[model samples]
Target: MAFTETTARLTDQGVMAMLTSAVQAAGASGQPQCIVIVDGSGVVLASFRMTGSRYLSLKSATAKARTAASIGAPTHTLPDHAKAALAAATGGDVTGLKGGLPIRSGGVLLGGIGVGSGSGEQDETVARAALAAIGADDI
Candidate 1:
């Protein structure tokens, strides 16, 4: 059977806006954070790390973003079994961490967002705030 696939992508403006929102959220929460946005194919679009955020969090943030984009879903919402399977399959490049979420709008997938350098809940919160800024939080 022949099939066609289509996907949405966030513009550079959108990426910057999300990053700004995440930084603002992290500041409000008094937590340093690293934020990363990836395209639908898991390519880094933009990233930022607040002062005092751990250097290692850069990798974590990218992994989370890539995981979400690859699966077209929020990393935190994946079933444990699915998480385990994906981790095994991706050799750890993809994670089931709560900081990652697929960026969707009007039911169209538009890449992903991830936050790091905080607790799981905090990271997720920051990521959500980023999505909200882009008006893509409904997903």
Candidate 2:
């Protein structure tokens, strides 16, 4: 039996690139955003809040990142009926917000990214930009 398994993870440089892309995307959209990134285990790796972004959005952004990492899918794909229960069960560590997307490379799960403080579509666009910047698979 194998004692361990190989897994993909995001590097610091990749994370930074993603962050930069997200910030630029948010800026181009003219909507300030709170951004969060987490590893496959849901540990936060990086976060940023743009100037003039809603302060409270940080919380939701974190939850969104964790949720996407935990589920290996986009937060918006979560069933509507299970949204509240999932959030409550996880003590707000997870969310069904539209801005979270799992980060993958070569079909392997690496992490997740979440963006907030904008419309759902805008937030998603920023997250998608981040994923694209790193050549990660789209969610």
Candidate 3:
């Protein structure tokens, strides 16, 4: 029986690059943001709250990152009916917010990125820009 498998993971440099890209995107949108990145195991890798960003949004951003990483999908894809239940069941660790996106490379799941402190569209745009900066697959 095969008991071992190779896995891809995000490097520190890659995380930094993604963060820079997210920050730029948020700036371009004229909205400061709270950004979170999480490993596939739902462990936070990096987080940033830009100046002028809403402090409370950091909580939702973290939840969104965890949710995407845990599910290997975008948090926004969660059904509307399940959003509340998922949040409640997970003690708000997972969310159905639109800014969470899975980070993948060549079809391998690496982690996730989440952004907040703006409209859903703006948040998503920032997250997507980060993924693009790292050449991650789109969802």
Model 1 misplacement above 4 A = 1-7, 82-85
Give the range of the ten consecutive residues with the poorest summed lDDT in model 3. Answer: 63-72
In candidate 1, what are the lDDT values of residues 16-116, reduced to their tens digit?
99988999999999999999999988889998989999989998899899988888888888888787888788787888888999999887888988889
Clash counts per candidate, in order, are 0, 0, 0
Per-residue lDDT for 92-111 in model 2, tens only? 88899899999999999898
**Candidate 2: minimum summed lDDT over ten consecutive residues — where?**
130-139
- TM-score to native of every candidate shown: 0.89, 0.97, 0.97
How many residue pairs clash in model 1?
Answer: 0
lDDT by residue (1-139, candidate 3, tens digit) is 9999989999999999999999999998899999999999988999999999999999999998988888889899998999999899989998998999999999998988899999999999999999998899979
The lDDT values for all models are: 0.89, 0.93, 0.93
C-alpha lDDT of residue 29 in model 2: 90
